[model samples]
Target: MSKANLSDNKMSATCSLSEELMALLPQTKESFKLDFSEKVEKSVVILLHQARELFYEGKMNECLKTSETIRDYSWEKLNTGTWRDVDKEWRRVYSYGCLLKVLCMCFKTDDIGEAIRVCDMGLLMGASILEDILVKVVNVLQKHLQHGKRPETKIEELSKKKTKSDHTLAPAVKLGTAVPILQCPSLEFFRKNYLVPQKPVILEGIANHWPCMKKWSVDYIQEIAGCRTVPVEVGSKYTDEEWSQRLMTVNEFISKYIMNKNDIGYLAQHQLFDQIPELKQDICIPDYCCLGSGEEDDITINAWFGPAGTISPLHQDPQQNFLAQVLGRKYIQLYSPEESESLYPHETQLLHNTSQVDVENPNLIKFPKFTEASYQSCILNPGQILFIPVKYWHYVRALDISFSVSFWWS
Candidate 1:
């Protein structure tokens, strides 16, 4: 009879539909063995089912508590090993717990903004559980919610001012040889000359066609994904002991890290294109990746966004990488596979791919041979793509507020 009552009925229907969808999710296969210990696996299964049952029975508070228990247990299991070592089943269980928890919260408190925030937290912090049901929930809830107010313009203005006045150039490195630049070479020529020979080359004019070349900017991204949660890397580099990751809204990241410039925070090496598909529409996968397995799924796309001075330590990757500079400038120094002996790669298995020596301010006393290592350096600008062959040791530092997309293919 009234608009408020009509809105309430719609929300009720949405929640009911969500619950039905959750019920329809396939149960875990009993035949498949989980990688966790038998005790952990048993707890995970029992707790997950209990959380779901409690939620279905309409015991929202109890359901929330049970879901939290499952989340904490699974998280402890996750922390016991490296990210790669963690079992996918444990991640799945953890994500399901998050889903149940968020739903219970929504059922108890009819706060659309808080509901969206919780869903975002699960999407960023949790794993792909139930075919990414959290994203679906976000889409459904977004229809009922209005967009938040724009961020303060002072930060925007300050960033533009800094970009213009802060002309601090990249420190002149000793390695003077610049990477060879090529204008839109044919796919056949690229494959034959650089890809086959495993040589590094910077290509121009190819990425000019991408919409991001013109449409993407700090203000634009903030306007689009300001409220969405994302994982931000804190500190100068991953090698630093103080380095750590935090999950926050993209707006918060921009306010505290990018615009404020309080500390170095890089949103590096994340599949942001997958998280925010709207941004992915702006760029296309390079044809050069077809030189590898030719499967679209084989290519790994990662987004790197950070302010000036964020450094990627000298490291080698197992697959060929094409680092495309979409915004701002970056100073990149690369070493061929032949120079591995001089690079002084870390001894530990975890850090073996990363070099121990700091390429920028090298300690020649400890790494005497680093000086003899031949390196090709470049000031990669917007719209340029740097093709790095497999195992090419590269050290990257953002010369300004930078955003780069990297495609890694075998």
Candidate 2:
């Protein structure tokens, strides 16, 4: 069968499970023909058709269920015949990690404390020991996809190759599972990098690539930081009870402000205390939480900076973002919109688009599927940038008294 046919078959197999389960996977808009290269086009075809059918049918429950089960078929077959059981279980443990994650999101939105528990269960499962990252190819592709700007370079040559190339830096370990294929990065180094495409860049040679410095340094930052403006969006409506309760500490920071999201559109302006002056650099951050260009807009840029314990709930940005760190440390667990089956975005209209679990302390019974999610973890230091694609579910922690910048672009 052709590539599109195969992935579609996977989705058809998914539809056979149940209508509710099938409604979970979101459409990518790109065709089974357009997505997945020749290598996985067949698989994409199978996955795509069932996804569309279930979504159309509103079989969210079944869509999530099938997505959970199908994660295994995508694992790379091993050479050791006897190890097959281990392989299957491995996929089950993690694929379910993604599954429970979705279920948890369903509950978190529909029900809450329960979703928090589910998120924790998934984390403990170690199902996602190996994870795939949101790889950003060259800017030309990003520019092309975002605004239909034609590539000055040859698009055909870039399209011809799969993702394994020099610029698209993948993890050090070999990933033996079926990875979703996106166009890899081009050879150009200066004008673009994944960080740049995702947001603006700030190079801090002093803090770039420090392995574990981000673990708990907010107070340290409050004392020694320099004057750099950060975005905040708390509205006039929220009283001190809600605002102070939300933005207070690292832990409270994540819950009320980061993960605890509502449409109040509250904001806070931040100033980092310690930016080494001899370095002669201070960043003028953008308020991307309310992002738009020239005049008309679709998104915004909201921000938080503090010690360990800060958090942001799993929500998708209508537009893409570039998140970079200036000091201390942080961790981000991410899942794309296409992987909604694993993340379990809400079903209830109240929190329909919001993830269900209280990522700070997830409750599991209500959101059993959160236990199955496999997410990409990013550690941002003085200068590293993480390009978070639009609509991906992300859970974040301060790790330390951290100073960071987020750029939201159309």
Candidate 3:
């Protein structure tokens, strides 16, 4: 059905809870034993329920006003309590208000991006309950969006245009050279030279002491992780239409991808350490993580295992990272946050953290600005750790069957 018709059907649904919502307002006002603050809380609950009824009754403006009132009340009255206490009631109500307001904005103003931003904020605030509802709203907006205006579609079009123009007009341009390599730099030296400057660097001796360097081979990994089911990336790169994810046993992954190079199957970004304690014993977190908030346990360790030629497209992570190459080699390219615009980061919410430009092969015609973006590259070899600062764009391609561990902290 059309969006308009779907909306109309939703509007036609009976709002039977209207009377119950109205009844709560008077009960809240007349409760003599209740404290003023308790009364206000009850009133807010009633108001939110009333707003939901109004929304079902097609009173979009009234629903929006009620939602805003709840938000304002929560902001002014509930900001003083401890987070553990406040999040139980006030935060949930506040998130509900935000969700309703965004839904109204989507329906009334047709500002899908604004709606999405509000949803992002809600999720960050821990409103996981609204995830399904938010997804449905985004799907509705995507379906109704004008042709060629959707972010992913627009990016695909730009990629095609660049490909066509590459043959006729602009010549290819190189991005930049390799990242500087340091041997066993001290924690202070690393913090001062690389972390502080937000520069990418390769450290040679950091992972030499790690037991994984000697213990983790294809045979050992297959024996330990064989039966465990894992989420694997099934494509060469995420930018392709055929790209997808699959779940399979580690044994199957090893046999299909590692033993024989049939396709680019990768165990990318899986928290293998958390899932397998035996594997965790093989590696240790680098000492430089102490430079952060000192919450050593808060560090997230992920495993990247894949066959030769598997590609991880240009993407950025939100935390400082130590990528330790335990087995085989990988070619990595990195760009600083300052060069984001030049790289043409994906405008779509889904791929917002990824770059549109293919780092290995640039289509200079459509993304000519990418030529101006300076980048650092490196070939991460066994027992080497590459420090990638937060929000730095990095791309990776495995030169051979590889197993790497990454620690994200900060």
Candidate 4:
């Protein structure tokens, strides 16, 4: 047979196999829930379909290009607190794209080792939906290596280099002992000592004059916002798959999460002051916010109310924040933007603003850099305001049935 005819037959057979595998997968009526803008999702799906078509046509190079496009887009969308059961369908499609790219690398470029490394990355990203296909790819690559058909890839060379580099750095370094507390510093003093240096400081007596400081108890909050439906975070922390958003009345939130500690639910980041004008009258914005970009109208005031043990993961905000403790105590930790590399920020786009390492109980073996990242910690008391500069990493854990308000300014 002619070489052209032989190649055509092989492509036809491969297309048939691809179709059969896809057919075997179960179908669901539920629509895939991607945790991104609709524009991003649409673009990714288009590229994914293009990659599949190229694969069936036996255009390995074109298939690889299209597959890589999908992979890159997926990585960018992989944000923290966005991964959940609803994303499983999108993840499955992403895994298929990764597998196609691995096949092209192995068969077309003869890079068996690189193909294996790519497979490992896909698996790490919770792409087990294509486990059967990945296993087959790995086995084939292993056979190629055993036969000495391909050269060792760059991944192996990099691994050897990393081993030498790892030994050069110290295993761990301790963070700061404590955060400083200032007793109502003037606007100029605060701007110079804390805001200019981008440091964190707990300011006492800032909210003592606010009526909310004395009036915002569980009973008072329930009485005022009891009937209003508000968004609540229903989990101990935002990182879990079971973590989800719930909308309920303020009274229900107080009864379920605060009154009884059966499960941790939080009325976090809600604009209570805006929603209930009565609440806004109780507190006043500090004069320090005028030191910012001078956009007072653009400032956002948000409320955070939750039971003890509720946690806000290590994350950075785009605006300068003034976190005021109103009714309870909270333990907070802050890391400067300079230590971002040491904090091991997530590579995926979804969690680009958050750290992958758990600040409380860090996995040193997996994230050794976290140990070298120094931080300042404090226990925020009622009537204290914490100044957090833009992009400063902060993690918060309520020590009691805490109620805090945060003002975000430019």
Maximum-TM-score candidate: 1
lDDT tens per residue, model 3, 1-410: 99999777544322222232233223342321212234346778788778777766668899999988977887654556655555445656666677678666655664444554454444334233433343344334433433333223222333343333222211122345767889888889988998888898888887778888889877678545554556788888888999897866676777666655457788985455654567889898898899997499889898999877778889999999999998878888888999999989889988999999887688999899998988888778898899999999999888777899999999
lDDT of 1 by residue, 99-207 (tens): 7877787666656666777777666556776567777776655554545444656456877767653344875645458889999999999999999999999999989
What C-alpha lDDT, on a 0 to 100 scale, does residue 65 get in candidate 3?
94
Model 1 stretches astray by more than 4 angstroms: 1-46, 53-59, 110-114, 142-155, 165-167, 170-176
Minimum summed lDDT over a 10-residue window in model 4 is located at: 164-173
lDDT of 2 by residue, 1-410 (tens): 99999878755543433233223333332321123335443653466456445534556666655655444444333223444344434433443434434442342233222332333323322233222100011111112121222223332343234112211222222243222221223324312553234422223343333432343233333222211112343432221235432322222332233333232322233221111221113343333333334332433333455434445667776656656676556656666566677566778765566786765457877777776776665555556556576666666665544556565666
* TM-score winner, 2 or 3: 3
Q: Give candidate 3 misplaced runs (Cα > 4 Å).
A: 1-176
Q: How accurate is candidate 2 locally (lDDT)?
A: 0.41
Between 1 and 4, whose TM-score is larger? Answer: 1
For lDDT, the strongest prediction is: 1
CA lDDT of each prediction against the hidden true structure = 0.80, 0.41, 0.70, 0.71
- Model 3 TM-score on a 0 to 1 scale: 0.58
Clashing pairs in 1: none
TM-scores of all candidate predictions against the true structure: 0.84, 0.35, 0.58, 0.58
Report RMSD for candidate 3. Answer: 16.1
For residues 2-35, could you state the per-residue lDDT of candidate 4 as single tens digits? 9999888756655544444344332321222223
